[model samples]
Target: MNTMKKLAAISLVTAALAAPADLTASARPARATGLPAAAKGCVPAMIDNFMTGAYRSPDLTTGSVTNTESGAMLGGRRTTRFQVAGNPFGFPSTAVVAPGDKSLLAVSSGYKGPTALAVFYGLRSEAHPEVLRADLSCFKRFEVNFVANDLPLNINVEVKSASSPTVYQCGVNTEAGQTNGFRLEFPFDCFVTNDPAHPPVDWTRIDRVLLLIQSASAMAANDYAINFFRLAS
Candidate 1:
């Protein structure tokens, strides 16, 4: 998304917030720019242009998985999962980690129909243990990207967790129907310690990852993609 366009959108949102009743009349459909006209529903377009620019040094390790093929599996069957480990690109100068800080970058191409994608990472302490909880560290973060045609995109993020089942859902953006795309970055401090209450991350043990993609409604056609990076010392 263009900076000027973002500014204009923010301005409109601010104006709407200032006067709730005048929202309907004050809010005018923004003239579409480079967006496709024939594009009826939401189409997932990769916002690669914004990422190509210069970023601070210490390049972070990054990876991604898409839901175009197998789709997300919930209960019965398994799903295709991908993983890239240990700062694939080597740590960049800018990729710095403080005592309690964790940073990440996540993005996705726009989706035309309806689709969802989630990416998560965890830090484990020590090797095997009698109690499962003893070996697990902290669930660094969880991120979700949702999109649908002719509707706005929804982006959500949460910090800290022990163990949680991954699930995906689809719905209409009834409130902000004009949203077409979104991007987010998160930073935090604190790690799962080795104590009984807060166990240390078992770096020696293998970490698990899960990705889910589901089409809840009929005539649903869309693409789901995500790229994530972790910053460490």
Candidate 2:
């Protein structure tokens, strides 16, 4: 899709959900630099590294990860989903972590419309009575290390709070010409809703977080992989 159409699709998706209540129109897109001076060289809080190579089905359509690594934000669960219901091009042909590979690799086969390989964070484990949440108030941005094969990918975040079950989303796209893979930073402020009546996203009570992929063109298969995802200061 061209720039105008791509942006229009983004706006339609967010408007269908609801608008943000507390955010200003001054929000910006993802940036490579500009971290606060105090946060320079600060260690990131790990969200997932996809090191376990775990998947629920043989086709790899669904899978779960229980992060045991140190510095991970939540110890509960994270899973992948490739929703195929309204998609005419069929589900992703490949979505798995190969035996020796540490990254979660996903390959789409000419899928159309808005579909994402979603990673859900802070899932309630069997031992927990309630949904687990990660307090990310201290983090100012999200750092994602990934490679895309010239696919116009949009990285979206969905969060929920105690007062509302409604899911609010905000996202940024990978910069053009970064097909070789790059580490991009998405600041928290970039995630905003369109409806002012909707409750603002509460970073302190974050019940769930999702990293999604949206491609503008679907004429061919899309290759994407992630090495690490984190919340940083």
Candidate 3:
């Protein structure tokens, strides 16, 4: 079906799923802070499941070296150590700022699995934050980014109770010279889900969103990384 039709179908499904009760309460969008007034960009939000590792060089002068061409004797061996850094997911944090009316919500999930991760937004201490039952009429667009290394990745974002998925193909690119730094952006209609069966019709009521990253066949260290998140006004 066409994109419009697909969106409509997902909306209908979401309405049905949310018919039981209103979970999110209507509230005014939060104002921006610590950012330039004209700087229409993203900022950091809460991060989860981040991994920590270090790069190290090997040393070869601790032991005596031996060499034998025909007898197969080899040189000395050396060991290197790696220190683990604390993962940021466990920290008590908040998005530097919240989205404005007509704002954009951006999130990153460390590689986990194929299930779309759920992201919830609400007052700092509200109960049932995941249920976005608020009137989010001001939001117009949703931009998502999945940051990682040189590996092919795909993501599908879904609003809970909706019936479709927002499919995002995270194109792979060459790793830049900078270590521990990379990002990708995928822009989508805030209301439409890439999958007709899972449209984000309830975005208007969304206080939180969930993202699911499809798993790959092979796994590698630093295989997944989610640097930051932002909500554009």
Candidate 4:
């Protein structure tokens, strides 16, 4: 599937957040020059450490499962479900608590169509799942810690806002042969949209945090271990 089309599909089905603007083919957000300096008195917050949480896995309609986990933010002990969507033709995909129960491991097999394994954050009510709104204006950037194997995978980080019809995104590409764990930082400004009329992201009304990991090729298999996702000063 085309990268832009694949991302747009995920945005539409998962949260109904909004449409995505024309994006760059490069492995980074369009119009992002570099990371900017943090603002004064900027406080740090953890989105998900993938640790210190217990969750129940329930099989979803797409043959994937949802992990209703205990979170460490938003009053601590916030219960939210992390979803796995777009597994090609119901191609088997799994999101599990990795060995040692320290990180979340997402794996996809026989990848044909773009599969987006997403982890949800912020406030949510199970009774009304679509209403997940959060305020992250206090932070200047986002930090993702994960380990990538040699397998080909396209990793994208996306954000949705309550006040706009554009979904903001930035690419976080990993080295082909690098197996070591690494941390990537993306400033909020790095997230942009091709639509100039709508804001790229409304930080104060951020409703969703989406991480998309798609197999790089057809019938390709890949896996990723996520350590944590955070917002920082």
On a 0 to 100 scale, what is the lDDT of residue 96 in model 4? 58
How high is the CA lDDT of each candidate model?
Answer: 0.24, 0.50, 0.28, 0.52
Q: Give per-residue CA lDDT, model 4, range 67-172, as digits (tens).
A: 4344443323233333444555655545554434556654434445344565554323332233344557888888877665556666666676665756777765
Task: Put down candidate 3 lDDT per residue, 1-233, tens digits, no spaces.
Answer: 11222222223223322221233333334323323322222222222211111111221212111111111000011111111112233221111111233222222223321211122232222222223333333444334443433343343334433222232222222332223544444233533534546434543344344333322223211234343343333
lDDT of 4: 0.52
* Model 4 / residue 164 / CA error / Å: 1.8
Candidate 1 lDDT, 1-233, residue by residue in tens: 11111122222212212122222223222222242322223211221111222222222233322111111111111112221222322322121111112222222222223333332221111111111111112322223332222323333222222232211111222223324533232222222222235443332221222222223333222233233222111
- Per model, how many backbone clashes are there? 35, 6, 22, 0
Worst 10 residues of 4 by lDDT: 24-33
Q: What TM-score would each prediction reach against the true structure?
A: 0.23, 0.63, 0.35, 0.65
- Which segments of model 4 are wrong by more than 4 Å? 1-44, 55-63, 73-91, 98-101, 108-114, 123-127, 130-133
Ten consecutive residues with minimal summed lDDT in candidate 1?
Answer: 123-132
Candidate structures ordered by TM-score, highest first: 4, 2, 3, 1
RMSD of 1: 23.1
Per-residue C-alpha lDDT of model 2 across residues 147-180, encoded as one tens digit per residue? 6555666666666554454556666655444567
Q: Please tell me which model should have the higher TM-score, number 2 or number 3.
A: 2
